[model samples]
Target: MSIGERIKAKRKQSKLTQTELGKLVNVSSQVISNWERGYSDPNHDDVARLAVELDCSTEYLHGISGDKLSSKDVLVAGQEINLTTEELQLFNELKKHPVMFHDLASDPEKKVKELLKMYKMKKMFLEDDEELGDGFGDLED
Candidate 1:
């Protein structure tokens, strides 16, 4: 299926009108129409927003993969903003091979679970520098 077709299907499946989807993604209804009609494709950022708002994978929208969400594999979607070295390591390793992180996420050990949780927290804070406040924001990315 084409990206436009997939976008239309997912949008309808999400029960969103073209205008509503446009608003969520910060585009005009006409832009959404253009995408749905195959007149133009969404840019990377728009695709990211669309996938998030439509609750589907960017790969799915692009027709690269049929799976909307893969349970066994981890996907680091969209662009990475302000990723720390450790966060990049975890993300890149998972992208290369899902085993290590899967093991860590599924591990019942308290420290392993907490480590995963902390990574998520740190990633969230770093994405928005304002959340870190003062000197904490600039930690040698």
Candidate 2:
């Protein structure tokens, strides 16, 4: 399918009218109509924004893929991160893992921070045990 057709189908699937989609992408309804009709195409930036608003990957929008994998903008430390195609694939794959989304979704950075702290603590304990001699319990008390 062409990019325009893909966009139109996605827009319909999302239950958004052309005017609503146009507002989201900051374009006029006529522009959206033109795009849907294949009279013209959205520019690169518009395509990116459209993909975000539609909760889809740019590759899907560009007809380069049919993955329909979702992506969202991530902001960390005031920096916006746009995930690449590989990252989007990884995100989709993560859903299949045993990890519960609720556990990781709430305060993700905090979860990672706690994991790092636990790892450091374990490492410190291992080093201290090694310094205390390999098997103190095995020695005659």
Candidate 3:
């Protein structure tokens, strides 16, 4: 499907009106209408924001790919953020944990903070263990 068609489809699927989608992306409903009508396209940053708000991938929106789940983009406090490969792997793993998945779905920021803390703790432990063979320690210093 075209980018405009994909946006409209995903918006409807999410049960959001154009106005609601606009608000999430910090745009006006008219802008969304224009997008759906193929009058204009969103910029890079807004495209990223749209992907996050629509729960899809920028690649999907751009008609570059069909795999939405492969997106490493996420929304945090209304900002579009890209996940590192390690972070994406951790996130995918977290999705398998019911409690963590619920927490992440409900409050992404908190879940992200928790994940960051866990990553730091793990890194520290690895760093302190000389037998670990500088797994992440070599990257630190």
Q: Can you write out model 2's per-residue Cα lDDT over 1-141, one digit (the tens) per residue? A: 888998999999999999999999999999999998899999999999988888787778888766676454443233334455654344445446544334655566555345445555777899999888866457555
Evaluated at residue 118, the lDDT of candidate 2 is 57
Which 10 successive residues of model 1 have the least lDDT summed?
A: 71-80
Return the TM-score for candidate 3, rounded to 2 decimals. Answer: 0.53
Best by lDDT: 3
Tell me the spans in candidate 3 whose CA falls farther than 4 Å from its real position.
70-141
lDDT of candidate 1 over 73-113, digit per residue (tens): 33422321334456446655545644544443333344333
Per-candidate TM equals 0.55, 0.52, 0.53
Prediction 2 TM-score vs. true: 0.52
Please rank every candidate by TM-score, starting with the best. 1, 3, 2
Clashing pairs in 1: none
Clashing pairs in 2: none
Worst 10 residues of 3 by lDDT: 97-106
lDDT of each: 0.73, 0.73, 0.79
Give the C-alpha lDDT of model 1: 0.73
Best of the two (2, 3) by TM-score: 3
Off by over 4 Å in 2: 71-141
